[model samples]
Target: MIGGFFDRYCGDWSPDEQALFEALLEEQDVDIMAWAIGTQPVPERFAGDMMIKLQRLDYLPIDR
Candidate 1:
């Protein structure tokens, strides 16, 4: 799910965004779900802006 979005839209994001998305992909599913649901903290590095971007996916206008 997230990986598909990354592949579709990551080219428009900065290098750091791309890296952060890849890092998220490498994580365990439970941790990812926790972050997605706000039950666990997202890493401080990708905290504010990046987290917002990822969480906004459902609301975004995805072309693919």
Candidate 2:
């Protein structure tokens, strides 16, 4: 999931966004997945445009 997100958006991200993503990488995978799936509340620091985009889950290839 993270890899797909990076592939789809990393190239277009600004340096700040890239840094934000890198910081996000330091978080637990389960936490990240929860945020992406909306199963848990996103912490204030991680709640913003990037998280919003992740929640969309459009980069994932699974049929819906």
Candidate 2, 3-48: lDDT as tens digits: 9999999989999999999999999999999999999999998999
Off by over 4 Å in 1: 57-64
Best by lDDT: 2
Q: Which regions of candidate 2 fall more than 4 Å away from where they truly are?
A: none
Ten-residue region with minimum lDDT total, candidate 1: 53-62
lDDT of 1: 0.72
Query: Which digits, one per residue and each the tens of the lDDT, describe model 1 over residues 1-64?
Result: 5665666677788887778777877889888767767889888865877677666667345677
Alpha-carbon deviation at 17 in model 2, angstroms: 0.4
- The deviation in Å at residue 2 for candidate 2 is 0.5
